[model samples]
Target: MRSLLARLSLLLVAALVAGCGADASSAEFNGVRLEQPYGVPDVPLTDTSGASYSLKEDREDALTIVFFGYTHCPDYCPLVMGSLSAAMNHLSEEDRERVNVTFVTTDPARDDEQALRDYLDGYGSEFVGLTGDLERVVELAEPLHIYVADGAELPSGGRDLGGHTTATLAIGEEDEAVALWKQDTSALEYAEDIHALLADD
Candidate 1:
């Protein structure tokens, strides 16, 4: 699984390196800027391993990479996850240990514990996977300017194609919601921002 994801990451990285992303923001943090440091709520969620997850407590002083999407997502979800995995791999062991990569499901109905684990393991075992009520997830995204519009189900009985915030949010020291990269940002770009944010602290 790791090999497959690595290959995918390499391929995507090649294409994405030239373009920042569809909504790429090349600001100070190499991500779209937020007007202020938005306070993330203490939203409750269940991790893939059945562990409790509290956003407020978990990210209090950690440089966290937060992504809002579902496991079944065909394009943005896997691409972003693979990119993030590769970015982390590019980091030194010490720097990698200081960072937290988290994924919150926007379509909880289908992303159960096992499903979340299976998908996340393909990227990085250390990657945190959280799934819970869809409405609650949406509530959490609203403050971050993320919108998850529901997509219609396909006639072929394939899983519903849901749309979500494709941005990979970075919450750095003191738990302040800081930078974010869009779908077009490359893995290298993400790795750079992670290093930059850590240095700013």
Candidate 2:
């Protein structure tokens, strides 16, 4: 897992650097600009409100930020969520309204609707949480190239809820992923990229 993360981090860094000098036709972003945009996953999952949510059909805003991680994650998940929460705080009310964030749990056994809701409320009420059968979750993540795997028991007796890709997908107005943000991206960067995307729209 450590090695996998290292490789993924390197790839993310390369992508970020590659996007630094985007052409006038493209919106300059702090995130890695995808050469080929990814369409929103067509799968439906159970939201915190126990309602079925489809990323492809039920997006509430023009831009949707989607991430897949479990609340039990020891490092990456909390850090990313905190950064995103801070980023949202930095946005103007209008820009905030143009963006929506959704967190889909890769560890479904422990992340029921209420649990997902409780965990996400700490980040932002507007942040949506979703969970379902692990197989279904994998189905939702596969198309995006978001990794998910079975966990292993930790040395401390706590279980590590497997491994998952830490990159966040920024789905644009056309239901396609226009950019990717690495796990360690700063809140200020997130806000800047979001504002730029909104401006382009």
1-201, model 2: which lDDT tens digit per residue?
999999999999988877774553344567888889887778899999999988888887989888888888889899999999999999999999899899998777888899999999999998999888877887877777776644454453323444546889898888888889989999999999988888878
Q: How many backbone clashes does candidate 1 have?
A: 2
Estimate the lDDT of model 2: 0.84
The models' CA-based lDDT, in order, is 0.76, 0.84
Cα lDDT tens digits, model 1, 5-84, are 99999989977875765435444456765668777777778888897887777653359899887777888888889999
Off by over 4 Å in 2: 1-28, 150-164
Candidate 1 structure, TM-score to reference: 0.77
Top model number, lDDT:
2
Residue 8 CA error for candidate 2 (Å)? Answer: 38
TM-score of each: 0.77, 0.80
* Clash pairs, model 2 backbone: none
